[model samples]
Target: MNAKTPTSPVPPYPHPAGGWGSVKALGISLMRDGAPLATASALRKQNKPGGFACVGCAWAKPAKPHLAEFCENGAKATAWELTDKRATPEFFARHSLAELRGWSELELEGAGRLTEPLRYDADSDRYLPVSWDEAIAGIGRALAAQRAADPRATVFYASGRASLEASYMYQLLARLYGNNNLPDSSNMCHESTSVALPETIGVPVGTVRLDDFEQTDAIFFFGQNVGVSSPRMLHQLQEARQRGVPIVTFNPLKEVGLVHFANPQSPAQMLTPGETTISTQYLQVRNGGDLAALTGLCKWLIEADDIAQARGGARVLDAAFIAEHTQGFGAFAQAMRAADWSAIERGSGLPRDALERAAKTYAHATAVLGIYGMGLTQHREGVANVQMLSNLLLLRGNIGRPGAGICPVRGHSNVQGQRSVGITEKPELAPLDRLAELYAFEPPRERGRDTVATCEGVIDGSVRAFVGLGGNFLRAAPDSQRLAAAWAGLDLTVHVATRLNFTHVVPGRESYLLPCLGRIEIDQQAGGAQTVAVEDSTGCFHASDGVAEPAVPTLRSEAAIVAAIAQACLPPNPRVPWNDWVADYAKVRDAIEATWPDVFQGFNQRFRDPGGLPKPNAARERRWETDSGKAQFIVPPPTEHESDPSVLRLMTLRSDDQFNTSIYSLDDRFRNVWGTRRVLFMHPHDMRARGLAEGDMAHVTTVAHDGHRRELAGLRVVPYDLPRGSVGGYFPECNPLLPLQHHAHGSHVPAAKNIPVRVKSAVA
Candidate 1:
């Protein structure tokens, strides 16, 4: 694992995010790798009213659809799923588990759609296709055994790829079987947002809607790259720029998406080869410095307010809003005033004048929209980082305004939806009382394990079984070196997925791969074709209808598979009619309505809405639902980074040619990384300081002294537009360098954003 393949020199992609280049990339991926006509037809339906939801990211779709609503990533994902290729039983027969383990991530995925249920063959060390009946029966028997040994021995992990209905059943199965060991991708990606937003704004989800972008005077992007994360939002950002809205970006690297954008649909613009400038100012804040940068912004605003008060001038802070709607302002203001300018300057890696300018831009605008991504979440102080942004918004009454609010740009189409319906470890987050009353079972109240804790449980033999709904769980997880072996040691591991992934290769003692229908494929039940729902980032519920033919006839719907697993594993319960629910998805929706009547009432009626239906957000109405009955102005720690000066903070990057954990090819068009994912990005000054040059093979080692000397050797060094004492590399590839124990303090999200590391040139 220490040695990596040689790669081309990382040449930066100078073009804006979407344009002729994106079109070219999309065409290449689809035409060469996927069924072009099939995927193109699917793309026409993607993000449209009653169409399939792109599982790429959770960005909301516009009410009125454009000609092509899908982005390059979404299109690539659709094409990837709608491919003619198949990792069929014959393919498995040709390659043993050991041989497949030697294959690359892209190769393993390129093996394509999993045709049927596969069981691990210990003697041959290969996967042999098994009948669905025998497969689920064996899984049920093993799962029951684990539960019988100890209720906590079985853990269920659901990824964001699952639909709302499928995820609901998955969670129900876990609780009914005893224990609440439900660790999910939400815990790994945006657990910080779930924890911090509720503590500050009285809501766990973002209050801003798609229409809010139209009226926002200013937009602040904290550690988000729109081009890769969700390119569909580029159109809105472009329109905002045209309307003279100021967009200020605070990130370690100047992402091209935040730089400028070209609408691929606009014939005149595309033909003319022109792109609109996106950001008014791009400040390269150091990795792990978001807390400091945000604190500095608040500090300047506070100081200015004090000076204005002394001069008897107009008030800078929203005094009326603060007094009426928020609590803890006095403590927050005092803490901001006490923050040292020297510490802020050092921590942010930007001069005081830059902070003043950014703060003035924010103060100058009456309505400002605050948006952030995972960059602000996967840190030791991630919760505080989010709260500080909340504090800044509260300073000017940004929340509950026409064009202003806090928006956490979540990844995954149904990640929020999954969490909304109780696929979470936190008992209080869900309507547990209602679920218990309706299901006739006492749902466990004890706080359950998260992603990291789940791994620990697996390693220590406490957790004996795992069922992944979807996702490359083992590959995407942090500290791959530590988890893979322990994960294989499990008694049972069931993966319900559409296609092959790295996890399929890392089989457990008793492993089963149950292929499921893709989102683009039609999912027919006893009633007829069913529509699955997904919640976008803006608290809107979108119903998606799959219209394509199934990749294989043997593939079952996720809901049906979950129901079968439940039927096979658990004793019959009249209260929870597993068969009746799968027979009609509408009944499942009615049950979901019954479980959360306050929020989800009239769910079946709302399905008739062409566009998505907005979920009620008290924060949007300026109604504080916190324990204190008011918004909180949280005080952030002055210093965000506590590492040694020599230690560089490494933030993980996503390649343009990939979606989450699924690499399409080796080519990264945005970063211009070709033929490899082992490249490391660093500032030139930092590289010079370490006596490293471009294309130099470097060994990156974690600074953590947790007895695990996690290191990624022979990572090619590439200079990037980043601040000093910071580096970045493609995620999950460099995930090995992140120790399992190093995570967000409160949220427990792995600190993939700012891993403390030291780099040195590797020997040839």
Candidate 2:
């Protein structure tokens, strides 16, 4: 199905600034709004026995056991949570839901923390305050009514912000109610990586430990902007750079943070106005060209290894490891040799010499850390892209070794945790078996809806009630207008959020906005202060608590909210200990321990330490988990197709200044964008091809196979140093161009990164 994209109807602001001026403007705005005074105190308290978890990115690296454990974004996240602003019942009384819906997402949520449970009243076109009991009862009634008809009609989605206990309860409650349709934010982002990783290895997440970064001889950064996408990781890269480790960066656009960065922690550098030069060399690749680049690299390596082998010398490839642990090298080798250099160079936007140099570098490095992000995943061939990267790593025996493994940098702080705790749409039998053993409930053996499927269900009238843990579902979904309309069509809708957001503004037939305590807020239950465990990308789970009082007196923790709903909806399900689990989060941890042994032993006791134990990465010990007990090389078949002559491959990206669906401000200083998120960055030649100049307004139109047209206009075209035929724009705003139906093959994740669109000069 196709949805019409919005016409840039009117320029967000005429005469928009470009170049360094835009960068300076954004920097000033960032310093003004991004600086946090309470971050120090909050971080200090974070180390205390009951400090809250970070509400920011889901990198669950423990806030360094002592001192403040926060990056710049973490500080902003803390400030965002502890802000004095409040969206009280009185505020809702002043503005009707209809009026609020018209407000920009930035304005609607920028107001502040939601302080009460709100129920939308059609007569008043506004949400009126309701008691917690009343709201829970309403949700329970909605679920009961819907379940009585069709259990699959209800969509229960959880976001990363929900605690481990809370997410567990959410799944439990949904299963008890007879629906396993748990479509969470993980599906929209890293679901592809999660799905492919396990097939390649035995686990779904990255295998690299932080310690490995220190020992790595070389690192490859792909399609990720460390400076903006993950700032905390920049320090680690800086350290590696300082050690003189060679770093090769591949991206369509040259990110400033990856080029040179000034670390706040380096005193000598701070005094000397010094900067850490991150990438020894950077390769400008085209969007959706990652597979091509990987193939070229592997091709060069195979040639080198063959030459060495003929000379009766050690092969450049990991011959011993490959012989012991892989199955498909023969097939892969043939594909690599057959891959054409012209196609690789044209598709990747890199010269053959540059590709060879990168290949030589990888061949020389004793250990290499390969890191990739959404740019590789958001494409028609995202899964293939991952499999190809896995092949590259395996060729040199990069897996099951120190300082080497594929790392998909997750965005949310506990996103990895959410997946670990069973918030996935596609539940693995092993995890489900463990869940059944721990909770004593036989979870439905049937499959469930992913993000795209859930949206389709909603649109096709198959989904009745929509309950979201903490995401901006409508905004986060592709085709915002269709998603909003479908959401509005739902029989009942519930949102548990810490702050006000655009999702809260859109009303359902029976809509409820339940304000939940933020990560920074204290969650004092009947059992007294409680700490929740969160798992990081590296598989380390640790406890987090809160120091400050609840942002609002009426607010409840996600655990409490989930439990209350479960108690109210499911009719006394004797299969699970719902009440006990929600009361004391420890009970939840106890269950987690039962499900996954050894890793979470004395789960509560281990959390007391400043350092948490890292989970096992088979690669770390040279134990390959693939079928042959070794890393396997996969040579994907080439797509015998040509790019549309009229369109270019456009990648939708997040700005350095914003998080997923959470727009702090309209300033992307890293990209030199200020006071706007509507502009598109492209190469000067691409702009010239369309008769568009820098700062010239243009219309972006997408051509669907069904002859439907989706377009956005009045977007100021800015010439960037990006690869030709490649373009980049901010997400959500550009989400409309991505069809909900356009997703990866295995997981059905929308290709938000690789969209083909034609550009033209805007009329007038």
Candidate 3:
């Protein structure tokens, strides 16, 4: 294996997920965070009904909680936030912004939590400490000035980690200021699901619960690596396997997690030195091939059902359910039957027999659940891809039934919750009338800029002020170089953050980094130690109260920060009660209930229950809220993006050691790549075809249809098990190659998963 750096020798990891390796990783995290005993105690409280939820992936908590419900990645998120180290004013005094910009992502965050609010000093190019009052006043003044000109001039960005209370406060602040410019982390990941699911199933969220895994007879995973992205999910998969459930995985790369997984918590498996096989069948589909694969499955199922009906056997198609609970089935079935097998095989890069076998499994199963991740959602046809999955489930009467539904696995802990509580660019979807009546202020009704629009706004000088609640916006977004430049051109940029990130250093004319409490930190307000609530991927609303003492005493909770800014910018409003809401988080929940009564009624009381209340989803009751009053079968045309023979389809992936833009380590332990992130994974055949071999340094250039080429140099090409004409690279580093304008059709999510690129040996 070729390593980009010489810090350590690259060796393939032959073991499965979560065994001695996970234990070792946890030990390293504890040592690095400098509080093993405290961290250990804090870990025990994670995901407990009485404690905080894991700040990692939003996998639903098990009904029967274990002593150690957290996964390896969960421990990393906790340790990263609860680190004993502090980045005080003195630390900033020694490091200039220019110097810090050159530092790695891991190095900047590892410096530790910000202990005070800091303002950018352009002359010194260093961050200087500013009082919280002054910081709020300055930001308030800037926001007010921007609103005076045009509320659309200001862009409010929220990270998925933010609690529902903070998310509501942020969105309310933006809307009250007369604009709906609320673009969140969800736009970059699962906006496709948000767009496609409602059109097909009349609801955006998954209908399945945590217990659904137990009852599911078959599980089909598409483009999702659960073992690495959501390790806790492996426990459910392992249990399902034990119950004779067949798991099928479709991904571009043969991820080890999909092949097998070993739970460290299971003493029998750990002591006996054996692992449970995860995926019964693994299909290495081509990048952006999910649509084709799903179409093939549908075609095969339709054929099998026709044969079954002709033979007077039990019908394979759910005729009764489909006839009664669905629309556009005739056209959908006709399209499926007419789908070309050669095209499906070519597009999916899988044989006809493979898809037929998968379809057979689905036809035989009583309950089938389909799970997908960013891989399916981060494409030009992302929305179509998601709808295709929904079509498959609807055909089998899988939806609105026990153990069966379409699940779009989210990366962030509360991204789903953020959307539920009104963190969106679309104003019509928000409960504006209810909010207006409660707050005595008219909310904006016009649709505002999304992530892509926000970037364009900043670049075109339309957006003058930017307020990021809790994300590395510049780095996480595509076209990093241009986005950073546009961000720097802003009049003001306010970031409510716990630690340093790439966005903090890319200062606007007047920038402020207001330190805030992390998920693991105790948020003590005037009323009491407040507990913030988050809705999981499965729509379960739960309270997460931090167990560890805050790393910095001066750090404010995200809710308080938003409220303080709102109080400073907006006029004194007796109805709003900003001060009271910040003083007690329950007041925020009360406001949410009043605004969204149907979903959040009795929120405060229901939140107190050990097991959190599940948000009411009408789809669970076999109710369709669409125009047809039934589930719609959307038959999208075939994927139109033609593959270039000379170009490899490149997809951005997260290292096992990283989450979003936060790099835990350069080493991607699962992939066996160590000490560096500037490496691209390619198939051996593809490398040979390109005259590139292992250890050869290559330059990757994006082949954009608009003729705007983007390139990344000095990337080491390493051989992997990906399909031919497909390659993979770590995100943020390869994000530069992604064009900001090149996004999904309806969702506007940057097509980060499918980039047509050509890789060649570096000239140097």
Model 3 Cα shift for residue 566 (angstroms): 0.7
Candidate 3 local distance difference test against the native:
0.88
**Predicted structure 2, TM vs. truth:** 0.93
For each candidate in turn, the TM-score is 0.98, 0.93, 0.98
**Cα distance off (Å), candidate 2, residue 122:** 1.1
Between candidates 1 and 2, the one scoring higher on lDDT is 1
lDDT, each prediction: 0.88, 0.76, 0.88
Give me the runs in candidate 2 sitting further than 4 Å from their true place: 1-37, 45-52, 60-68, 437-441, 639-642
**Could you give candidate 1's per-residue lDDT for residues 247-291 as a string of tens digits?**
999999888888888899988779896889999988999999888
TM-score preference between candidates 2 and 3, better one:
3
Off by over 4 Å in 3: 1-12, 641-643
Task: By lDDT, rank the candidates, best first.
Answer: 3, 1, 2
